[model samples]
Target chain A: MKYITTVNGQEYIIEIDQKTEITVNGERHGVDFQQLAESGTLSLLIDNRSLEAIVEEREDAWEVLLHGELYAVHVQDERAYRLAQARGKLSDASEAVVIRSPMPGLILDVLVEEGAHIGQGQTVVILESMKMENELRAGRDGVVTRVHVGKGDSVEKNQELIAIGDAEEIKEQQ
Target chain B: MDNLLIQKFDKVLIANRGEIAVRIQRACHKLGLQTIAVYSDADRNALHVRYADEAYNIGPPPATESYLVIDRLIDVAKKSGAEAVHPGYGFLAERADFAQACYDAGLVFIGPSPKAIAAMGDKQLARQTVRAAGVSVVPGTDPGLSDDELIAAAEKIGFPLLVKAAAGGGGKGMRPVHEAGSLSNALAGARREATAAFGDGTVYLEKMISDARHIEIQVLGDSQGNVIHLGERECSLQRRHQKVIEEAPSFVVDDELRRQMGEVAIAAARAVDYVNAGTVEFLVDRDKNFYFLEMNTRVQVEHPVTELVTGVDIVQEQLRVARGRRLRYLQDQVKLKGWAIECRINAEDPYHDFVPSTGTITAIGLPTGPGIRVDTGLYEGHTVTPYYDSMISKLICYGETRGEAVLRMRRALEEYRIMGVKTNIPFHQHMMESHRFLSGQFDTRFVEERFSMSEREIHDELEAAIFATLVAHQRSQRASQIVAPGERDTSNWKWYTRWERLQR
Candidate 1:
């Protein structure tokens, strides 16, 4: 069986040919792992090198902690990957940048107006949650097409607040 | 003669939460006194609440409704019969009114006199007070300085200064002006941000001391007019004005410099008539010219570094001072024996601009061994709500030399683990391995401008990929498999156990 894994914008083509053998990015390796317990601890032996990490499954991704750093890994089988590619849904942020509220909060301010060009890491919206004003920044640079939440409006977790598309699309709308 | 006959308080009501509260409880226990913990609705299962002799629910999770409510805190103290209240670092720690209320309620505040807190709390008044004692302060103009006046002041204070908002903190409304040409534009931008964030446009100009290290003196005072300094703590490693790493007996500061800074710190404490534990912060330039920054009226977050080196328990001294007793040590008795370092373990993603991360801590593996002390109010199942500061714990390591301490800290960082939330442990680990940090050549802006944690490559990426894929494959396989019932209901292991019993 073959699987496609994406991590930090890098993709890996993994093939599980044998029980204790696998190939990642065209490199074959002998790999075996045991789940220590329910605490997400994993003792892995890859190519006879013993290692340990804490791995947990989230809603849409597999989070792996190695050497005190976390890597959010997205994996899909070969067919699913091809299907996703056909549908143009590959978790790419530069295509259509959407700003979602990470937690429940009130929209303190909308710093950008519609049809405005915003840069990556720019504070597009200010959300006040738990009495702390957190600046929700844009994940990628794009032209804003819609402002979903207005100032002073309450928002829930994962609620989309703004959508930014390519510059050409905004020009057409204008 | 009977000043020590009556104890100040039999029970201490800790008017704080999290690790500091637990820290205070440990101190009170060492003194043979009871501890009363007050918690918000969100902190019911917190380690501090569980460790206290008695716990009380004050109010809701928000600080305005719970931790900062003076009346509610006092009510809990009174109901619990706690004769003294210890305000830990944040929350109501530095509130002079809270201390006054504690005094008015006939309770020992376990800190400085209310007048002292008020004087130091005011930035201008603190400058004036410390200046009267011949202590040099950072050159700056008064608050509400207009843009035109600021431009003029910038020339006097020289270039590479900071235009800071009077009512701003956490690096908001703060702009760095490298030259006079940008001072006006910087002022306008800072004013706008300040007005929007703090609702006040007041601004000030301070001469930014380049190549400066943040060294603070720890002073402990008793009600008997005796005060002594417990040496100095180097806290130059900061991110956005918040301390990330701290160590005692700064590498830059020698014995003579330590004594000089200690005297200045003691002088500032005397100026305010400060009682209990306080830290006098200073900005020491490259030329060894140290100027007083401000005084932290309460115990600081990095007090453990000093405690580990000087062999002094500051919290216990605070309790003793609250009891109207003399200080335990004299100035001559205080000594810095070895090096100690502390890393603040915050629940923030260092890779992603240090944004606050919140979730339940499903599992925690604390580091233990030689020269390690972990101060935290966390447990396995504790939920890290987004209602407060992101710092979940402090990992401190002690050693006879700075190199040894750094090595121990690196080892401890590798051993420590906290699941279900992001942390800056990797950042600390990277710093421990960095050449600049090991050589003590970095300044306050090192983290903000120079260092990069994400630039380094993860060595175990291949192994991680392999394990994750294997786990995912196993899970998918298990979900697809359908188990069939066997002829024997019990397993082979159960039959073997029964056979052993029959043989017996």
Candidate 2:
């Protein structure tokens, strides 16, 4: 089985011929992988060196936290990668992006209202969490399709705070 | 104070959460005193609740509805039969009204008097009081100075002064003006920010102490008018005006400087009639000139560093002072024997702009060995919510010298691990290895201006890539494995029995 893994914008091709043998980026290495009893923990021996990591599978990537660093690793097998490339959709950069609450917190302010045009990197909402005020910014330039939350509302992690979409795309959806 | 008039409490109620609550509980338990814990809905299963002898639910998670509610805390104290209330730093710790409420409820507050708290809690009032006591203050205009008056004062104070809010801390409504040209605009902006943050637009002007270090003296005063200083803690390493690291026995302070600062700190505390455990903070310039900054009327967040070096359980002393006990140690008995450093471990993403991280901590690997101490509210399977401060733990290391302490901290930071949320561990790790930090140099502005987190990534990207790929591959293999029933519908044992019967 062949897997293409992208970590922090760097891509590597990994091939697994046997349970104990693998190659990464055209470099052969003997490997032993063991999933520990602890959920999301893995002990891997690559080329006779021991390394440990906590790996969680998310919707689009396997999240790995190693050495106090967090990374979302996107791993796609050969068939899936080729199919994605063939569709001419190698990235989802131009799609609508929803500004979600990163953590449970009290909404301090909603800087943008529905139908308000916003620019990339402009703060859209301010949420008070962990004893500090955090600004949620727009990922790209677009009109706010919907304002799902308001000031003083307590929100859960991943709940939609607002959505940004193309004016035409928003109209079509409505 | 007469020994016969001692006020002893059999039980103590901790009125805060997180590591400081647990720390005070330890002190109470050490003196054979029972500890009662109060929790909000979000902290029903928190570690501090489990560590106490009794736990009471106050209210919901939001501090306003629970932790900061004086009636809820007092009710819990009365119901639990706890005679004393220890308000750990934060929450209602610095609120003078909370202290008064405790006294009104016939409960001893394990901190300064309400009068003392109020006097020191007001930033402008504290400055005036300390200055009247002959303590050197950062040359600043008095509170209630008009914008025109402030501008007038700035000219005398010289260029490069600070416009600061008189009502709050943590760098709110603070702006630095390099020249007279921008003083008016700066004052307006600061006033607006101050109004929004503290509800008080009162601002003051002060000479900005460039290249300054933050050094604070720990003071223990008994009800019998006995006061002693416990040396100093250097807390210059900061980010956005928040202390990230602290150390005892500042690299720049010698015996003479410590004595001078100690005397001035005592003078400041006495000016407010301060009693019990408190800290007098100062800003020290490069020339060793010190100025009274403020007085913290409760146990500080970085108290462990002082504990590790001085071998003094400050919380216990606070309990004793509340009980009317005389000072246990004289001023001459205090000593800063060795080097101790502490790093505040917060649940924040260091790779980003230190955004708070929260989730259930699925696993924790604590570092243990010589010279390493971890005071934390975190445990395996514990959830971290955003209803409170981001600080989850304090990691303190001690040794005979600063070098060894730094080495120990680096080793311990490397050994520490937590799962299920991002942490500022990478930031602490980077700081421990930086040459500027190891040399006992750098000031308050070092973290923001001189320090960068890009180097020393210890990039385990290769391993992360392999593990992620292997995990995906394993899941796929498991999905492809067919677990169909045996060839025959009948059970294997029944088929074997029929074959045996035919043979017979």
Candidate 3:
């Protein structure tokens, strides 16, 4: 079976066959993996080299600890993967993904207004929760099409606070 | 003669949770005292509770309703037949009222006297008291000043000063104003933060030492008033004024400076008639001149470094002092042995602005071997809740020299393994390899303003990627494996149906 694996925004085409034979991104690799009796522990031998990985299933993603750093991995099957690729294309064509609140908090301040162009990693909103200020930044560069919340507004986890879209849509809105 | 008799307690109740509580419990057990752990609703399954000889539920998850409730804690201690109460660092540890309550309940408070805690608990009052003891403070105004007066005081004290909340520490209610133009605004912001966090908006201004380091001396006193200092710990490596890393025998302090700071620390403790284990913190500037910051009237969180370097078990001394016994070592007998460094392992994601992460620890691989100690409240399958502080463990390493200590810390950090939650281990690893940190050239702003994790890209990228891809591939295979729908020939109903069809 052929699988599309996406890690940190990079996609790889992996083909797995019987007898521990696999090809990753068109490059063949002979890998054997054994799930140890201990949960979330994996022992892998890649091209006769031994490696260990600790994996945990978080709420919506998988957290893998390799070496001393942690990586969040998101995996989707073939059909879901295709749908995600189409969605990505659609978003790139016109609109941008909406920025949502990562946790429940009070919107202490909003840095930008609608119709304003924003670059990626620019602070759009400042949230104060648990007595700490959290700066919510834009994940991608786009023009602010709409602002859904204002200062002092309490927001729930994953609640949409701002919508970023292509320049044309923002200009139309303006 | 009054202190000649050693008072003993059969049972001591640890009124705090997390690693500190577990630490106190260990001390109590070593001294042949039974430990009782009091927990909030959220900490029912905490490691401290499991480590205690007995456990009791005090109240709900919020500290105000549970751990910070003095009456509730005292009631639990009494009901559990505990003879003493040990409030470890946070929560009610530094609260004078809690200590008084413990005293009123006829229980030994395994800390300083209530008088000392009350005197030093107020930041403004502490400044006045320490200055009265002939120790120079950071030149801050007195409390109860109007906003207009605060601005005027800031101008007089100079443009660069800090507006600090008079009631609390830990970066809460503290704001640094670089010029007169921003003093009023900074004061307002500081007041709001202080009020929200500590329930007191009263703030004072102090000269801001831009290039200063946080150095604190540990002091132990008995009822007989014999106080001795335990050298100094460099806690300058902080993020937003919260200490992240600490080491004993500060690279900044030599023997003469250490002696001066130690004398000042002893004076501060003497001013308040402090007893048991307390920490006198100072802000040392670039010129080696130190100013008294505040006195922490309880055993500090980073006491382990001092313990390792001085070969003095601070908790054990705190217990003994509470028992009215004289200190084990005099001022001259107190000696500094080796270098010790401690990295506070907090359950915070360093890459994501140090936000608190919570989950059940699925797998853990703690570092072991010589000269390394991991004081932790973490257990396999233990859950880290969001209702408390993010600190999960403290990894301390000791060595004959600073370079050796750093190397050992690097080794231990590499061996430290925790899953199911994010940590600042990567950041520590980055710091271990940092040139400035290795050279002992960093200040409080080193972490926030100077240090950047982006620079230290994981060197083992190729290895990590290979392992990750292999794991991912195997996971996908297991998930996609098609299981046989059913045992086709083992169904009784299907067998009877086939027989009937054959008969027909």
Fnat of each candidate: 0.29, 0.64, 0.26
What TM-score results for chain B in every one of the models?
0.89, 0.88, 0.92
Winner on DockQ between 2 and 3 is: 2
Q: Model 2, range B65-87, lDDT digits (tens) per residue?
A: 88888898998998889999999
Interface RMSD, every prediction, one decimal place: 3.2, 2.5, 3.1
Q: Can you tell me the CAPRI class of model 3? A: acceptable
lDDT of 1 by residue, B1-504 (tens): 537535968999999999999999999999999999999999999999999999999999877788988999999988999999999986778778899999999999989999998898666788899999999999988877678887887788887888876655545567788988888877876786666544567888888898889899999988778989999999999986778999998999988898889899999999999889999989998899999887889999899999999999999988887888788898889878889999999987787777677788877888899999999998998988767778899999999999999999998998888988889999999999999999999888898899997676667665566667777877655433323225446533344446547656
lDDT of 1 at B147: 82
How accurate locally is residue A19 in candidate 3, as Cα lDDT from 0 to 100?
A: 53
Judging by DockQ against the true structure, name the best candidate.
2
For every model shown, the clashing-pair count is: 0, 0, 0
Residue B65's lDDT in candidate 2: 85
Whole-model alpha-carbon lDDT for candidate 2: 0.85
Residue B97 error, candidate 3, Å: 1.9
Q: In model 1 chain B, which range of ten residues has the least summed lDDT?
A: B478-487
Candidate RMSDs in order: 5.9, 6.8, 5.7
Clashing pairs in 1: none
Estimate how well candidate 1 is docked, as a DockQ score.
Answer: 0.33
